[model samples]
Target: MGTRVSIAVVSVAVTAVALAGCAGEVSDVERAQAKVSASEDAVAEAQDAFDAASDEFCQAGESYIEALDRYGDVLNETAPTVGDVRTAGADLVEPRDDALDSAQAAVDTQADLVSAEQELADARAELAAAEAGPTGTPAPVDTAMPSASPLAPAATVDRVDQAESEFDAALSAVTDDTPLSDASELFNSAAVELEMAWLRLFADAGCLADEQQQQAEAAVRAYTTALQQELTTAGYYTGAVDGIYGPLTVEAVESLQEAQELPVTGTVDKATAEALQAELIALGGVAAQDAVASTAAVQQTLKLTGFWDGPVDGVWTPELTEAVAAFQVELGVEPTGTVDAATIAAFEQAISELQQATPTPSPSSSDG
Candidate 1:
């Protein structure tokens, strides 16, 4: 498996690598190197995980096979007193079969991943080699270019705030009777994101001397802590939250993300963080029926307007609200948070009319 690093490259170019262990400074070269290092580490860890998962998957499979052999022995040793007893005994075999199937599937998945990561490591190494050649695009001479992100400061501030909030929540979640394995991992990731954001800010602020090293250290910490928090939040808690992106956290985040139906880059993103936060909140608060219903409705509305997927639990979110406002903008309706009678009536009519016109899976929310 080839490793793909989805790191956001610094548009601002730096001719050389930033010094290590500085508080809040970084160059593009350092950023690139850090990213490559992360990818390499991830591929290595994924290989280890594949090995571990294979062990468990194989062991579980063997256990099931042994159970089947034992069952066969028992069947040969004793005739069932009745047909129902034999049927019940046969039913016991189903769980064993299911276990074996699941284990083998897991083994297959891990085998594929190991291959993919090795391929990626090769591709990246080759790219680095190519970049070294004379024909390669010349490294930019400037490191002072500004970031091109439209939402730079605001986004950074938002990220830092989220990091702090998630940290506090994760702390509480882990300490609570019901440990929040998911939120803990994300909080750590957010912490890393904050560190990354801070370094970017320092670079943008023209911190050239020692801030460079500080920023590099911060980026490492940001990525590492995020990985750690994710691991803890998954049922795979390893160690203390030391704000270091080590091997254990990387493996844990990848596994958790895999379980959560997320991209397995092992890097925590916005959606993953949000889902983790939601999970922690759920652990704290009793999920109300109305909340689930509202979430479903939001999902329905987003899908209707081509923003959301199928599930619509009624929990209102900023995205859902913004989406609803956008829908209202399109429909010439008031952009209120509540889905009032007017909005529903309009949606109902629109969905009915659309479905009536096109008998595809484009049926309205009302139909559901």
Candidate 2:
């Protein structure tokens, strides 16, 4: 990845946390439950957005997947077309270019929704298991994670997945020659999914100074890529990853718009952009993976200070929670499951402070 995005883990930002005061008072379990629920809501929203973006693709005159599949080559290389007939000297809009942009947006939106759902699913399972068994708090609430919202029930996750499958298959079946109205319907469906997704995330992930900016940027990138990947994965082409903003992207956009029954113009207006962004955000926040990998990572950091004693299996069992609380006690910090920047830095500092520190390893995605 060419982009350099810095994550502002709130736990590490002590001053910021202090100034902000309490975000809310929720038990570790309660917070975890909320995050899961919020995640579920987001995925559902993404599903709707996916449907809308898909509609846009169909409206541009390409109903089948082949239009996206052949996007980069056809639009990037073809001349612009604005009218019905290819006249000897008439000014034309690059139908292919417009089609490509809309198509890519839809693809990226779908992926974000899927990933969010997965993450939430994992988190929810672990939280549920913890709640069912022991009584003592395993770990303090994860203040680091986004707080919960009642509106985003966990059930929505299934809806997004279901919608995605249907939308993708239907979108793929579209052809450039498909009826404009049908294309428009698909685009509208995708938009609906996307819109719902965005609202869910915004509500769940309220504004936190430390991580808020970082989250916003991440939301945009994740959604954009997710939208694009949907088309590419489905077999559409949207030029290079160099971010050139070329005609191929335009064509993909137009194709998607035509499919949605939106204006055939190649531009993505404010309403379109907002709708796409909202859907992406919702999908991005929709799911949680089991805290297993996360558990291991947390345990390793705490063990140096004797905060953890149990095995590191990615599960957030009671033993792990006790270890976390102990670590928090020693650090004079709230022992929530949330790993804010302060907790992370103290963990890092403690490794050196107490010679028991095992050399911390980077995350899987960090190394290569």
Specify the highest-lDDT model's number. 1
lDDT digits (tens) for residues 168-198 of candidate 1: 4533443324322343334334333333333
lDDT of 2 by residue, 1-368 (tens): 00000011212332343444477554555555655655556556665766676567544423212222222112122242222212211121254356446656655655655555555566566577567657644443332333323222454333434434543454454455645343332333342232233222222322112343333323333333333443233233354431112234345555655655666654443333333333334454331222123345454444433455555543445555555555655655556544332333233223222332233422222111
Q: For each candidate, what TM-score against the reference?
A: 0.27, 0.26
Candidate 2, position 184, lDDT? 37
| Full-model lDDT, candidate 2 | 0.40
Over all chains combined, what TM-score does candidate 2 have? 0.26
| Candidate 1, position 204, lDDT | 32
